[model samples]
Target: MKLYHHPLSGHSHRVHLFLSLVGVQHELVEVDLVNGSHKKPEFLALNRFGQVPVLADGGTIISDSNAILVYVAKKLKLTDWLPESPAGAAEVQKWLSVAAGQIAYGPAAARLNTVFNASFRADEVIARAHDILAVIEGVLAERTFITGSTPTIADVALYSYVARAPEGNVDLQGYTKVRAWLKRIEALSGFVEFRKTPVGIAD
Candidate 1:
């Protein structure tokens, strides 16, 4: 397997962290988003969406971070990650939704604004992010991981971006439950962290 990733991209970070946590060994192929490599013809042909974290699993090419999580987990028979039963499966999908929604809008969007000079209105986005953060804080106060006591794809799905939320000017300072949850995820075995620039996913 080969993973195409950008160091600063939290979406890519989710895939990287999941692979490491589950001890899935793969060759890392860095995609230099900074240099417009993802937008090039070759990459565009591989993934019409031109997104980071395009995973090549033998002859199969999978794009999108959450999609990669499902594919890899299912391929490896990681039933715990994707689950098999109805409630357990729905629980997994629930937090994946959070990954694409609140977590994306909060930490991911904020990271873009700070690091990429992204066109979003900063204050508004941050406030909306904080509102979501408050809900997460309340939810986390009652549980260790997002889905339940043990870590699942839900935890792995949202960990990277939210773990690095401060970079986006979203405060983790006031959310004690969130802070505790961060520590919980980090304490897990084989948890590789997200990297930034000139490393991890280099050109």
Candidate 2:
């Protein structure tokens, strides 16, 4: 398997982290986002969206980070990573939606502003980050993982951006439960961390 990714991208990091956790032997092909490599014709063939983190598993090509996570988990029969029951699947999907929506516009977007100099309202995005973190802190106070005791794709989905929220100037100082939850995920075997950038709060 080959993973086309950019180091600073949380979306790419989540998939890379999952692949490592599952012991999937794969090669990393770094996309030169700094030089418009992702927008070029060759890379566009893999993903019309011209995004990093496209997975090529022999003849099968998968785009989108969450979609890649689902495909790999299903193909590897990782029942714990992704439950099959209706209730469990629904719970996981709920968090995945949050990751794509609130998390994306919040912490992830904020990070993009600082790390890549993308245009985004830091005040608004940081506010959204705190709002979602408050909800997650409350949810995690009652359980070990986002959905339940065991970590799920939901956890993987939320991990990267939240872990690096500080880089977005979205402080993790107040949410004790959320901080602990991040540590728990880090303690997992074969865990790979998102590359830290000295920006935002660090600046």
Candidate 3:
């Protein structure tokens, strides 16, 4: 398998982290986003949206970070990563939705504004970050993982951006539960750390 990605991309990091956790032997193909390589025709052919973190497994191709997580978990028959029960599946999907919506526009977008100079209202994105963190903190106060006791794709989907929220100037200081949750994911076996951007003007 080959993962086309950018190291600093949280979306890319989530997929890479899951593959590592599952001990899936794969190759990393870095997309040169700095030079607009993702916008090129060849790369666009892989994902018409021209995004990083596209997975190529033989003839199968998967895009979107959460989608990639679901695909890999199902393919590996990792029931722990994705539950079979309808209720459990719904719980996991709920957080995955938060990862795509709140997490994306909040922490992820804030990080993009700072780290990549992407135009976004920092205050607004940071506010959204806190709003979602509050909800996550409340849920995590009584559980070990986002969905339940065992880790799931929901945890993976939310990990990278939340872990690096500080880089976006969205402080994680107040959410004790969220901080603890991040540490738990870090301590997991086979866990791979996301590359930290050096503190710069973004700080």
Candidate 4:
């Protein structure tokens, strides 16, 4: 398998982290987002959306961070990371939705503004980050992982951006449970660190 990605992208990191956590050996093909490599014709052929983190497994092409997660988990039969039952799948999908929705526009957007200078209102996005963080903190207070005791793709989906929310000036300090959750994820075997950048600056 080969993962085409930009190091600074949380979306890319999502797939990268998962592969590492699962002990899957793969090549890393860095896409130069700064030079608009992802939008070029060759890259577009891999993913019409021109997004980083396109995964190529033999003849198969997988796009979208969460979709790649599901594909890899299912392909490898890593049912522990992604359960097979309907109720279990629904529970994991619920947080994946949050990862794509609230987490995307909230903490992710806020960090995009700071790290990449993407044009999003700082105050609005930061507030949105805290709002979701509050909810996550509350949910985490009731259990070990997002769905239950075992870590799932739902936890992976929510990990990268939320762990780095501080870069967006969305403080994680107040959310003790959330902070503890981050520590738990970090402590997992084969866990990989999401590359960090100073707030309001590129590295």
Q: Pick the candidate with the highest TM-score.
A: 2
Model 4 residue 41 CA deviation in Å: 0.3
Better of 1 and 4 by lDDT: 4
Q: Once superposed on the true structure, which residue ranges of model 4 sit more than 4 Å away at CA? A: 200-203
> What ranking of all candidate models by lDDT puts the best one first?
2, 3, 4, 1
In order, the Cα lDDT scores of the candidates are 0.84, 0.95, 0.93, 0.93
Model 1 segments beyond 4 Å from truth?
196-203
lDDT of 4 by residue, 37-59 (tens): 99999999999999989999999
Q: Ten-residue segment with the worst summed lDDT in candidate 1?
A: 194-203
Score candidate 1 by TM-score against the native: 0.94
Instruction: Give one digit per residue, the lDDT tens place, for model 2 in 1-203.
Output: 99999999999999999999989999999999999999999999999999988999999999999999999999999989999999998999999999999999999999999999989998999999999999999999999999999999999999999999999999998999999999999999999989998887842
lDDT per residue for candidate 3 within 60-104, as digits (tens), equals 999999999999999999989999899988998999999999999
State how far residue 159 of model 4 sits from its true place (Å): 0.4
What TM-score, computed on C-alpha atoms, does each candidate reach? 0.94, 0.98, 0.97, 0.97
Q: What value does the lDDT take at residue 107 in candidate 2?
A: 94
Residue pairs with backbone atoms closer than 3 Å in model 1 (clashes) = none
Clashes, model 2: 0
* Top-down TM-score ranking: 2, 4, 3, 1
